[model samples]
Target: MIKWLEIDGQSSVAVARRFARTVATAAGFPEVRTEEAVIVVSELASNIVKYAGCGRMLVQWMPHARGYRLAIVASDKGPGIGDLALMMKDRQSSGGSAGIGLGAVKRLSDRFDIHSTPDGGTIVACEFLAPGLGLHPSIELAGLFLAHPDEDICGDRWQAWEMPHGLRLALVDGMGHGPQAAEAAGTIIDMLESHARLPPSEALGNVMRDYRNIRGGVASVADIDASRGEIGYANIGNIASMRLRPGEIKRFPTRNGFVGNRSAEPLAEAAAAGRGDYLIFHSDGLKAVGADMLLPLHGHNCLLMAAWLLENGEVLKDDVTIVIARVHGRRTHAENG
Candidate 1:
């Protein structure tokens, strides 16, 4: 079971603290554990208000196969960090006053992941594992998944998905670049993620409603029934997508329109135009990696190939991110097993 709580406003810190205490008691966590969670949440939530004027907090508790897991996400589509590296350093301060707020957030969580783009926004995630539980080594072997940057404002973003329905997927490239661009990208991605189980077309429509909140953006949603060898999809804007099988690469075309504005055509109309074998998504960064190289990988290796192309290919000056998912084992049994 997944429990979700979203809180907003200046009192987000207080709300997070109260929620943490409630989660702790319900989950049977120690008092100290609850306090630590609340403190970290407060610090981050406070940063949201100070920096972004407004922010959002999402807290989720779910049962992992190994044990229970807690996730805290705080996001603000505001002026992004100019120097994320320095900001993360324990002694560094953006305003010249030193405080261990972010550092404390790091120390308190079992696993931490942060992504920020100069033009895009920022996403900070904290994962708390039940004491004494261990993560599967195989999961770590995949490394921390990250998107490749494109030239200037590359509006693309992606995340891997595994679901009961099959291998679900998404690719979103916000309308433009910078803070607004990031907001669009994040909004689209978040919507698809929320309805990952729905058909690609249906999920796309759901996200379309929120696109206005970000100004405008383009997105594609796809899901592969690996057992059935079928992949369904919907797309809009210039965000390009493809499917790579063992030796063949297939491209999905996009219909024109910015995300935030409803053109003469409906958002679903663009989505209704389905295309993809498996699926690969790219912002304008596709020009960097030759279109020919898109489908070289046989299975899971596709992700690595995409990463290599983004890093080595000259076409990127903006943020570049590509996602490739296969209905069948993209890797050999021997390789994955």
Candidate 2:
């Protein structure tokens, strides 16, 4: 489950920390690890209170090869950090204290990332693993999903897993808002997870077959083969899928129909996506006019790029979801050995 907290003032810091601690403990984190997570949350919330006046925090569970990890993400619309490198120094204070907050967060997290622009806002994401699970290199993926204002559940959902061939991904946007929409989208996600071993087209067909009679949704699935530098994708309805390579952005084709109610066969398309290429899948809730803004973020970390798009993209009055995957270059002989 994903939880959200608003950090509006000093009191909100304690609230955010408590929320993080509760989530960590419930996720089976050890007491010591839970304490570390609380500290990280405290520091991040404090930063927002001191520098940004107000911000938001998202806490969720992230799956890894060994098990699950805690993912804490903090975002603020305040004046962005001007010098990220300087701010990361142990003693360099942007808010006049000892300034160890961010440095400590980086040290405590198994995976850490931060992105900020002078005028654009700042987003910090950290992932904490259970004890004895050392870091391992995996395919890069990041996604964001938000419900429409005044809604408790988001109708849009995304999921990805590393397969033996490479990575398989799915993005779904239900027909409308609220509980029914969430159920439709979530059911599609469950189907995708269960039938992940099938090819994209076949997997989607299976989902559609089982999803008949339910509220319909638009969906896209992709199989990324990093070893072969290729991607196989299929989509039904309006979910947008795109491939970004050097100097070009190729939008994949999608058939017009609903997944559960009625749909045409979506032929899987193959395309080259070498190292440094990015594959993006997003629901129609993202405005078409703002789609071009993704060009400049081509080479950045997937998490940072996703956050930036979520922050700047025009979100309609519906649930929105965006998923990004980037292919890493071939490993060196020394690293492989």
Candidate 3:
């Protein structure tokens, strides 16, 4: 599960620490690692409160390789740090405060990434992985699934996996919120998973044929072709899809129909996309404005970007799922599997 915290003071810092400890324990980290995670959380929260005055944090224990890891992302729209290299050293104070916070977080985390721009503020992402496992170096992807406020089962479902040519990601929101909707979502995902090797439009078309017996759901799929340097996107319903390239963000209009029932004709859009390009696909449970307002964060870690969007824009009335991914490094696509 993913949780978001609002941090502006010492008390919120304490809350963040507690959250870190809880997730660390739940993720089965050793005691020593848990304490280190607490320290990392405290330092991250303290720096945000002291430098930015107010910011947001996202925490969750997610699957990584064979084991799980705790992911913590802190974001704030304050004055961006200058000379981050100098600030990363011990005792390198910038705001008349102890200069060891960022350095300490980097030291304690198993993996870390930070991006701060004069215009985009700061985003710090860290992960504490379980012992005895290694991370895939070729590709990185992250997503979150949230059930409706009143229901135990989420009608929305999402998945990301690799193909021989590139990567395939999809999000499906079953017709409504409940058992029937959940079943429809399950059916659609099963169909998509079986057809993942096909193009986005063809995959959805497969679902359309087999999904007629079940309740229908909206679906959006994207195929990232590394060789072709293109992103092939197709949608069967109202799920929001965006292509964020350098200096520009493009939003695709919903195809305006369902997969099984009265669906629109299957058509896929292919656009040029190479390294550093990002794609975002989310269900309608999140407001459309959420993605627009967080455009400054496009340069941050994919997990952090996904969390920030959900934290601010969740409509709280339906199941919400958001997946964020970026294309980088020319590693072979099969390396990701």
Give me the candidate number with maximum TM-score: 2
Candidate 2: C-alpha lDDT: 0.77
TM-score of each: 0.48, 0.88, 0.75
- Per-residue CA lDDT of model 1 for 72-167, tens digit only, reads 766666677888777887646666644455767878987665655565455566766666666432221111122233323334555546655355
- Tell me the tens digit of each residue's lDDT in model 3 across 96-134: 785456777788887777878787678888877787755
In candidate 2, position 92 carries an lDDT of 70
When 2 and 3 are scored with TM-score, the better candidate is 2
Q: lDDT per prediction? A: 0.56, 0.77, 0.76
Score residue 128 of candidate 3 by CA lDDT.
77
Encode model 2's per-residue lDDT on 143-205: one tens digit a residue: 767777778888887777668857888888889877888888888888888887888998888
TM-score of 1: 0.48
Off by over 4 Å in 2: 1-4, 62-67, 130-138, 289-292, 329-337
**Model 1 vs truth, CA RMSD:** 12.8
Give the Å shift of residue 131 in candidate 3. 5.4
Q: List the residue pairs that clash in candidate 2.
A: none
Which runs in model 1 stand beyond 4 Å of their true positions?
1-155, 264-278, 288-292, 295-300, 329-337
